[model samples]
Target: MFDHIQIKVKDLKSSKRFYTAALAPLGFTVQYEGGGAVGFGPKGAPALWLGEGDSRGSVHIAFAAKDRAAVKAFHAAAVPAGGKDNGAPGLRPDYHANYYAAFVKDPDGNNVEAVCHKEQ
Candidate 1:
C-alpha cells in the first residue's frame, strides 16, 4: 500500500548502522544512499529510508519474517547495534493466535518490528 517510508534521524551514521544490522535478518540491506539518506529493502526495491535530521515522532515499521527464528535474530542483532528493546520475541495472541513478533526502538526512537504469522 506504500511505496516506501522515510524516517528522519538525529545521526545518519548511527541510524545506518542500526538499520543495517536490524534489517539484515529480514533480508533487507542498504540498496541506495545519498543526500544523507539511506534506503533499505530487497536489492531492487527500497522500502524503508532514513535521513539525517531532527528526530521526528515515533513511527512503527514492521517487516515480515520467514519464521520465528528470524524475528529472534532481528532482536539479537538490533539491540547491540543501537536499538532499544520494546517487545521481546513472543506470541502476541492479542493481535492474532499466531502473531509472533519482536519490537525494538531505533536510536531515533522509531519502533521497528519483525513478525511471523505461522504456528510455532
Candidate 2:
C-alpha cells in the first residue's frame, strides 16, 4: 500500500552498514546512495530510504522473506552488524499458523523485522 518509507538516523554510514547486511538475506540491496541518503529495495525499486539526521522517534519496518530460512538469515546477519535482538525466529501462532518471523533493533533502535507467511 505504500510506495516508500523514509527513516532518519543519527549516522548514515552506520545505518547503511547495518541495513546493508540486515536486508541482504531478504533480497534487498542498496539501490541508491548519495547526498547523505541511501535507498534500499529490490532491483529497480528503492522502497526504503534512510537519511542522515536526528530521528523524531523509532519506527518498525518489516520486510517479507522468501521463506523461514531467510528469516533466520536476517536475524543472524543483523546481530553481528550491530542490531539488538528483539525476537528470535520462530512460529508465532498468535499472529498465525505460519507467521514465522524475527525482530531486531537497528543502531537507531528502529525495530527491523523479517517475516514469512507461508507454512514450511
Q: List the residue pairs that clash in candidate 2.
A: none
Separately for all candidates shown, the number of backbone clashes (residues 3 or more apart, or on different chains) is: 0, 0
**For residues 27-64, what per-residue lDDT tens digits would candidate 2 score against the true structure?**
99999999999999999999999999989999999899
Query: On a 0 to 100 scale, what is the lDDT of residue 80 in model 1?
Result: 98
lDDT by residue for model 1 (47-84), tens: 99888897648888899999999999999999999999
Worst 10 residues of 2 by lDDT: 9-18
Q: Highest TM-score: which candidate? A: 2
Which TM-score value belongs to model 1? 0.97
* Cα RMSD for candidates in order: 0.8, 0.6
* Whole-model lDDT values for every prediction: 0.94, 0.96
Error of 2 at 113 (Å): 0.6
